[model samples]
Target: MTTTLHCHMPLPANFRADGFLDFHRRDAQQVAERVYEQTLEKGLLWHGQPALLRIALQPQQAEASLLLDGASRRDDEALLASTVRHMLGLTQPVEAFEAVVAGHPQLGPLLARQSGLRVPQTSSGFEALAWAIIGQQISVAAAVSIRRRFIQAAGRRHSSGLYCLPDADCAAGMDEASLRAAGFTQGKAQTLLRLAAIVASGELPLAAWQFAPDAAQIGKQLAAIRGIGPWTISYALLRGFAWLDGSLHGDVAVRRNLQRLLARDDKLEAAEVEAWLAPFSPWRALVAAHLWAMQSSDGY
Candidate 1:
């Protein structure tokens, strides 16, 4: 049986399809694909069931179709559409962010060059947190390799033959030894197991964190977990919950790129990055994404 749910959502005027598509193409995880620069296909587990999503990007909106083997309830369809919007960053306030930063001496030009960029989120909070744990202290290449292995070891396969990252319930069922076998450090494996268990038991309330008005409370809860720190939490919030205010000043890429953007001879301290980003409150994460996107192409 073929089940398909078609949905569409408005996109920001400056929406750039490449920003979203290129991100998924960064690895050969076989989990998602950029069929072209403007279209994407991803397989994921939704509510413990397999679904494949295909998105077509237009200048003003995104059209998506969710494919499932079984019938979906009306609420499930609605939730799935919401997830797609979040994943594609259609929910972000890009126009407002751009308007606020239009006058900034440093960011104005960068934004002009990287216009329409929005921070994309993962399918679920657990996947974002788990990826952050797997990515700690490793180079992007190394992290990608480990992540691919981890997914193959613990994730579920859709009928389309793509593997989806394990959700909290699946991760909670995973053994530390399995993660270790997938090239995770002992500490990382333990941390992921703890996080998964916490989230699975509803002790963390991670899935609902995005809708919660109090970000500080959510931050404190994430910080209480061992091995998860400010950087991890911030990254998870940006990628998992789609909260754009978390300070990612500790990210090495952000720091390195900032120095390059400023043409500074000295390395930037975390305090310096934090202070520099202070004025961009409520959109600091978007600013960080801009910094992360800066390179030779941006004339930096």
Candidate 2:
């Protein structure tokens, strides 16, 4: 069934598409039927395929539908509805709540321009670590390409364009040679393996990273890993999950966006950009999201 919902009189500022798509292995369509599985998925496959859903969530209502390869499954329909309910942040729409905190001396201007900050508690610490390793020193598109390869190799299949990101057991089972063949550089491969080992062995409490006390504490946890640096950690904190206040100054795209937003010289320091975020503490993530939205808006 194709589902749609009406707004709650006061419409939400933003909505999430592909709430489960985040779990997809950017490249699982090629290799196998049973790959890796995502957290939100009900099982490997309703009939051996990744599930695609269209969910429209507003504060008052949400609607989700999945037509599994032309056959509708009520179980899939209910699962889609339930997952969307939890992930959309419709219960609180904390974006509004965070707005109140945005004017603090720490996060004033960034919050001033930002309209929404929806938090979805999904990512595991291991996923964050692995994503951070893959994203280092690369364009978002290039990183996505690499991610597709990595995910397909380790991911379990669900439906089309969806799969689970590899887990420690899944990834660790692969030899370095296998990873290298999938385009992981030796250093990157090593880093990923180490990160997997840490998560798998219980040395790092990545599952608890999202609720970390403050930026400093979160930074400490992230940087403790070998390949994870401030930039990489901050990126994961911001996107791998929804730590809204995390800003990515080292991100070339964000840096360029800031330069454009500020109308400044190319050499504008990352510190200065971060300083500009003083007014938007905790809400900076929303600001960053808006800027990204602007860039992707109108398909520019």
Candidate 3:
């Protein structure tokens, strides 16, 4: 039987569907199915059901439509809507970010150039953690290739030819050889397994981090994991949890963008980046997003 559910979500005035799609398509070549100028498809586990979600933007309109091809239960509509909202960051208002940008001469122009850009969120913290681990110390292209292999090996296959990212259970059960065969180095594979095990065993509460009082505490919990570092946790908080205060001071791309924005020849250290970002305070994540958007022409 074929089941279909449709939902229309209002987009914020400044939300750019193309920018978000560009960002999503950049590192998701293998792990996600996005057809530019058309639709984006992905597999999501919603309320214990595997949903094949396809989203398309309504041209010249301040809204987008979501189609869930595999969802059967009517009750799952709320969960599906929430998932899409979280994924696209539609729930967060950009006015405050625009205000912050208006104060900064360097970042202000970006607001106009990439008006509707939002930081895309991963379907789950587990997926975010997996991507973080896979991307460590590797170029984005190489990381995407490895992630595609890993997903094919462990992700749940959908009839639509899309794959739902593996849950903690699937990841925890993966052996070192299998992960290594997926292009993971011995150390990275071991780290992935260890993290998956911890989450699966309830030793590490991935979802609970959202309730933590501060990003620092979340950082502490993630850092305690075997291979997760400052950069990984920060990136996860920004992209996974949609934490607006999260900054990418330690991220190479952010640093490079900062240099370009400042027109400086010398690379800025983490401390320097942090110092410069202090003024942005609660909107630092938006700053990072703008910086990433500026680098779109050069490839992120």
Poorly placed runs, candidate 3 (over 4 Å): 1-3, 27-31, 47-49, 60-75, 207-217, 297-300
How far off is residue 19 in model 3, in Å? 1.7
- Say which prediction, candidate 2 or candidate 3, comes out ahead on TM-score: 3
Regions of model 1 farther than 4 Å from truth: 32-34, 211-213, 296-300
How do the residues 115-172 of candidate 2 rate in per-residue lDDT, one tens digit apiece? 4534443334455556667778875556666766776677565445455556665676
Q: What TM-score, to 2 decimals, does candidate 1 have?
A: 0.93
The global Cα lDDT (0 to 1) of model 1 is: 0.81
Model 2 quality (TM-score): 0.65
lDDT tens digits, residue span 1-300, model 3: 446666667766556777767756765453555555746777655433455677776653333333344546766566556666777777556776786577567777767777667777777778887888898877778888888888778767656767666778778888999899999999999889988998888877765553232567667877887788877887777777777777678777888888998999998998999889878878787788788777764323
**Two-way lDDT contest, 2 vs 3, winner:** 3
Best by lDDT: 1
Query: Candidate 1 has which clashing residue pairs, if any?
Result: none
List the candidates' TM-scores in order: 0.93, 0.65, 0.87
- Candidates ranked by lDDT, best first? 1, 3, 2
Tens-digit lDDT string for candidate 1 (232-272): 88888888887899888888888889998788999999999
